[model samples]
Target: MKTLSKMHGPARERGVVLLFCLIILVVLLAGGVAVMRSMDTSLAGAGNLAFKRDLVNQGELAIAKAMREFNASGALAATGATSNNVAAANYSAVQLATNAQGIPEVLLKKTDLNGPDVLGNTFRPTGTPISGSGGSTVRYVIDRMCNATGTFASIGKSGCVYTPSKTETPGGDQSQLATPGPSVPSPPIYRVSVRVDGPRDTQVFLQASFTKPE
Candidate 1:
């Protein structure tokens, strides 16, 4: 009876050892899985941020290009569409809706604006890049700073915003120059609104109040 009791005790000890090993193994596996999931979440977050930066770059490029074209129009591009056919179609309408703050605001979808005047203009780059922003499409709008839409002449709105550059000229005070001291009219500020649509559901909007002499 003593020998039989000793054998049963040994068997019980072995079973306890086996159970502890299984619990340790399970804990290790759970820890490994948690680490993998954390890494995946971090990677996804980084990817999203990179895509957003790309979208912003695209929007800024479009706005700058549009401003250049606007400044180059020496003779003042005609108001109506088809008359002034630059690289991209030109529109003379203020399509951007503003909030109570009176600042221009719009999401600016590519599908609608890519077509005609009511939506604004599509930004067409002069040359394609070797590698681009994942084939993003950028659209832009240029609004002549005026109170209402239509010919500025008809609305009695002045296109030019004059800010005299008061500087000392070679001849005495610059302001005290001859009566007709070369009527150098300062350029008017135009609203350049640009929106970029990227491949990874990224959208970006940028605006610059550009001014250049005619």
Candidate 2:
């Protein structure tokens, strides 16, 4: 029988296991770093969304204040008040000029808080903020949806957007039939824009248009 002999033609591979282990370690480290970065981005996005939602909820306060001002018995609806612009009350009888964003130019003019806008039109005074706390402030402006000032009759139907006070509609009795009522002139639609400034330079703008009967 031929004698079996150990033939070592080349040096046995050394540190092969060590090299394999090092490569695996590097791959795992890279995966871990990628996962950590993804987590951070998700956390930041969630935080920003939460802040925005909270700020929007706070805008209800401004809406309530505007409703009060337009109350039939309130100062704004009093004799001669509705027909004229009241700067102190932050109200305008005519619609104000707006920017490309549809945001009132007056609200964008911060250099002079109460100065005129880019069109040289007087800024409707925002007056004092309706409410503020914890680095948040809420303010609003009201404008009648009309091209000209004065009573709705004087502005003519083409100059303003309005609806009659009493329109034929279904009553609250759950009946589908229409209920008839005499049509009477109602106040023109008024737009209220609320601005909320919050922490981290976050700002929210909201608008609501409504009509109040005289």
Candidate 3:
């Protein structure tokens, strides 16, 4: 019998084993890469959700602030010297002017906290009486008062409404008389509405109604 050469026999077998080990390493590397990619995608989605939740919270706070201002302005009162409930009109007009003028002052009027008449950017509905808070990324309208009463109660009518157009939706209609005994009368109630654009073409709406404070 012929003796087999040790180098040709065992050495060749060792080379084959080395090749198999290399292939296994390559496969593990590919699997690791896939896992890493999946993790990255999950992280991105979580980040986006967190950002959106933050925006919603900011919007809700903005509405509350606007309600406080509306109460303070005496604009929501039934008997006040300058109680026009024209917050929506005034703010809309100002915003229109700013959009047309492209002046920093105009934008600042609605955005600046120290501006003369800090609540100048509020939106007041005529019949509904909506108010708003400024200085937020998204604009909102909150109505704290309404002029409706009697059998045709206007409790549900009081709330917020989003107005992207130059012209906003008018608030609830007031009753001509008080105490709808023979005829329907309107009493003053309150409403709050909020509108926000998370991004271009993305809009959200929120509305609520409250009884007028005694």
Candidate 4:
């Protein structure tokens, strides 16, 4: 009988085992790479969502701060082109209409935020960081609810539409607890617009219409 060495049995068997091991190694490597990529993608998505939440929170803060200024000293009373405050950051209705389209984005001022050809960022720079504990800067604007923008008094025909503080949408037979009566004094409403910008090209805009008693 021929010897096993002469038949090349050991070498041939060893070669087959090595080939199988190499194939298994390649498969393991591929799986590991796929898992790593999936983890990286998940982390990136989570980070982006967190940044968005931060921007929204900053916007809320802007609205609150602006309201506080109103309550504290009526700081926003005459803050526009019509007012003598040359350093004011607000704009009059006529100014917004003539410069841009007219109503703001929230108020359907235009199709898009960049529309009407001119409704750019006109809020004041308080020098306060927008994120506070994060990145970017925050700025806000307060437009008194009115049709025209010369002064609060100039909104004549399309001026303040009084809805009670607790007013509800006119729908089903819900209790008319907050029903607004014409005899009630028309409380002033303010339109608050805020812009929050952050790193990696993050940007958010928020607007709210609110009223507070004098």
Candidate 5:
């Protein structure tokens, strides 16, 4: 009877050992699956960030185009040219309405000003979308920092943000000059807003402000 009992005891112990091995295997499998899922999520996040950075870098192209348009010999170079809204040039002499975030309402996809007078007239890259290396499209709008659209004299310096540079023979003060000092009209500040559209329906907005000689 003792010998028979010993044989049964060893057999039961073997079965218990096999059950423990299976439990350990199951635990390891679950841990491996969890790790793989975590890795995949991390990879996806990194890819999204990289794509956004690429889109932002591509915004420089729009900014460069706007600068050229505002420089001398460009369509917006003359003082009279900036006195009114030029839909073709995407230029506005008066300040544009902006959203709560300070983004121009004209550049928004859906806004009250989405008519031909505003959103429908934004300037694209030469009337077409300029494709970037990452398949992004760029557009921009320029607005002069003024309350109304008209001649500088009509709007007056108080109505616009103008920076005056003294050109009165260096040391000569305008108050002391015998005659009205040479009219040194400082440049007016212009704001350029750029929008970049990229893959996955991602959109990026960039803005820059500069002064150009009138």
Candidate 6:
């Protein structure tokens, strides 16, 4: 009888040990699952950030392109030239104007503004506003100008200006002026503003100024 009791006691202890081992295994499995889920969430967030950054960059590039086109037109030579041309077709007359100084005054077209009043005045992009795989879109605004001093200025909304050198001798040759007499600095550099919209309500803005080629 004593031997049977001892055997029974050992069997009970073994059963208890087995049960504890099963519980420990279940806890470990749960921890592993939780860790895996956390890693997945982190990866997804990283992907989204990258997507937003790319969209913003694309928007900035679009603004730059528009500024370049503006500089190609000689509209910057004269002050009071409205960047918006409702009469010219596609804004072409305004997009590609050249003054006597051979300066172009092509300013960026605002997305809010309609196309030029006349046909053939507007600048149409072949393939712009590239949408990314992450469901993002980009928009751009470019405002640029070159002043008479050969300095470039880009104002965002207001217009730009260029001033001719003042004649030093009351009536002497204007071209021979030793120094530019007191004169207002040319208008501010043209500015290009870009906006990018991404999935999940993500938005970004980027801006650049138009500069004359070195």
Q: Report RMSD (Å) for each prediction in the order shown.
A: 8.3, 5.3, 11.7, 7.5, 6.3, 11.5
Q: 92-165 in candidate 3: lDDT tens per residue?
A: 21121122333212223233311112234433332222232333355554333323222113223232222212
Q: Estimated TM-score per prediction?
A: 0.56, 0.79, 0.43, 0.58, 0.72, 0.47
Best by TM-score: 2
lDDT against the true structure, each candidate = 0.53, 0.74, 0.42, 0.53, 0.74, 0.47
Give candidate 2's TM-score.
0.79
Candidate 5 lDDT tens digits, 41-105: 99999998888888888988888877887678778877688888776677777777778787887
lDDT per residue (tens digit) for residues 1-214 in model 6:
3555443333334478789999999999999999999999999999878776687666765665555454535443344443343222222222333334322222233333333211224444223554655577665433334222222333321233323223334443556665656643333445454556667767676755543321
Residue-wise C-alpha lDDT for candidate 2, range 96-210, written one tens digit per residue: 7777787776666443445343335575574677556667888778888777767877777567777644452423232443664554565679889878888777788899999
Candidate 6 segments whose C-alpha is farther than 4 A from its true place: 1-11, 74-136, 142-184, 198-202, 209-214
lDDT of 1 by residue, 1-214 (tens): 4555433433334578789899999999999999999999999999888888878877777665565554446223433331232333333343335545443443343353333232354333222212246798776656555444444334332433333434324443566655535535444456666667677666666777754443
What is the full ranking by lDDT, best candidate first?
2, 5, 4, 1, 6, 3
Ranking by TM-score: 2, 5, 4, 1, 6, 3
Clashes by residue pair, model 2: none
lDDT of 3 at 181: 35
lDDT (Cα, tens digit) per residue for candidate 4, span 20-118: 999999999999999999999999999888878988887788777766655536455434433222124332232222225333543232112222212
How well does model 2 score by local distance difference test?
A: 0.74
**Model 4 CA deviation exceeding 4 Å by range:** 1-17, 77-135, 150-182
